[model samples]
Target: MWNHTEVTKKLSIKFPIIQAGMAGGITTPELVAAVSNAGGLGMLGAGYMTPEQLESDIQKIIKLTSKPFGVNLFVPENPVVIQEEIERANQLLEPIRQRLGIKKKSHLPQINTSVFDEQIQIVLKYEVPVCSFTFGIPPRETIHQLKKNGIVTIGTATTVKEAIMNEEAGMDMVVVQGSEAGGHRGSFAEPFDDSMIGTMALIPQVADHVSIPIIAAGGIMDGRGVFAALILGAEAVQMGTAFVTCVESGANELHKKAILNGTEEQTVITSAFSGKPARGLKNEFIVKMKEHEDSLPAYPIQNMLTQDIRSEAAKQKKSEWMSLWCGQNPRLSKHLHAAELIEMITNQIEEIINKFHLIKETERLI
Candidate 1:
């Protein structure tokens, strides 16, 4: 009964658990299908994928499973490009690139303003079951178009005001990403630093403000976190760090190892890798860039400049220069099959419920 909620009915999934759609190759087709087949919703992190790449992955997922899956896209941002800033960021990263033996310089990033639109068309063409947006809410027309096609639209938010914006835009559900969330901060309405509310506090506040279903994300790693979110007024939970170490995850081995071996105090939020603030293990690159983070070009720009360093570092087995994105609850991470992870969480939830019921029965007898 705990797993049965509005999210389950609307998403048409057996369990209320949804794997966080982590971009940068973490949510592979196999992982997505495995999660969906295991009774929870699996999502493809298509934010960084090309339109063609998105279509190809969708086809692959279709062959792997008939169960419903979701695709997450990053809402396009139009930051003012500063050539001077780009040069400075590149200058700061040159030493790392040299250390990794990367000979070629990274070119200026090309901003694809129409990529989101093209991705939407792909989703419509394939009739994907669910589409979620991060960084910001999509246009009202975009939400309307997705809803018109019967595709569930979920928006990410870090504050109550952002949740209300998603509802006004007609989002079917809103994922309130707490400050404890890994990867990029989905705080679009205000400065991310001011929007860093924890999952426990953000869920109930957003629930009180918005009538749409709330999917709590951030520091949610197991059944205890899931049950806690539901009790905090969330209809469901989205987990990222818990899935990053799964066997099916496409994350780099070193990245997985860093998280597995990482402690709760090791992770920090930095915008050096990408023009946006994200939580990950503090490494040499992060430390070197800390002083210059505020001066770097806005995301996608800064993200482009550091691409070579991250890629080469991974190839050379140097995690010190790589981005090991993780949440505050890294100690709870486990390496297992996606299905096994789902089953474990489910069993844990069931045991917790049974224990509570036993307690209630004993109290009644007394």
Candidate 2:
């Protein structure tokens, strides 16, 4: 039997499941709306979009579903770029660029101006029901403003200390992203390497430490994983890899095929594609960039530099060159509609619960 929890009640969602906001153009309005319409909380990945794009997508999602949805923003990082490091990375990339038939000087791509404040303004203008953030905690003033506008706030954390920090900052809930999760690690308080806590270990510890509801995220691809997370004290499970195979997913055909055919052992946590460490399928691009990993420029810089190459690769359907971000268990991802996927997961959880009850009853009879 499904049970309503603090997360479900607070979010006004029928199910205690949230489709992970897999940013970088992967979380399209269609996917978000489908998930919301299916009774799960769907979130728009606003982390990579311009304020204008975010506003348009927000409006689109609203048009499609009356259910409450959330937007996730990346906490900006303005790291000082060591010119020498960038230069070395460029030299390392020159050979690959030549291999890909591109001849260009090693120079940083101009970054699009960050519209964080404007994006926040858009969220408030729409009265978006929820806002979640990763990479780092939002400024207290920002949090305060959102709360004043009646937006339910969530913060992503990679450690127990970070969860406590989120609670202290007055967030409505916390998403504890474990080490096995795809995409970027949400570690900000310390070096990310040291913060690699797994879901099984992290959820219970975070639950014990924070007063707010805990949402578990990582290698959770099925209902069994959701059942396990709830038992470990999570109020809900946030899944990204599983949703990548959904019919409404924004992943390319190659991305979907690669994910379905891939395995946990095929993934590696690398900063080659983007300057920050994110888990993705190991391809020739990732393999060649390994040597220059330490010298790559910080995010937004290296990420911008490689944008054209990635785009061209995608145009050519070169999976090897695509980011292909995925969690540990890619094989478990199913190709289903978002609504159908939710129903399948719900049934799986119900079956698990029923089996447990039957086992207990039989034990009592004995």
Candidate No. with top TM-score: 1
Per-residue lDDT of 253 in model 2: 78
Residue 216 displacement (Å), model 1: 0.3
Total backbone collisions for each predicted model: 1, 0
Whole-model lDDT, model 1: 0.92
Q: List, residue by residue over 154-181, the lDDT tens digit for candidate 2.
A: 9999999999999999999999999999
Clashing pairs in 2: none
Q: What is the C-alpha RMSD of each candidate to the true structure, in Å?
A: 2.4, 2.9
The local lDDT score (0 to 100) that residue 162 gets in candidate 1 is 98
The digit string of per-residue lDDT tens for model 1 on 147-197 reads 999999999999999999999999999999899988886899998889989
What does the lDDT read for residue 142 in candidate 1? Answer: 93
Error of 1 at 157 (Å): 0.6
lDDT of each: 0.92, 0.88
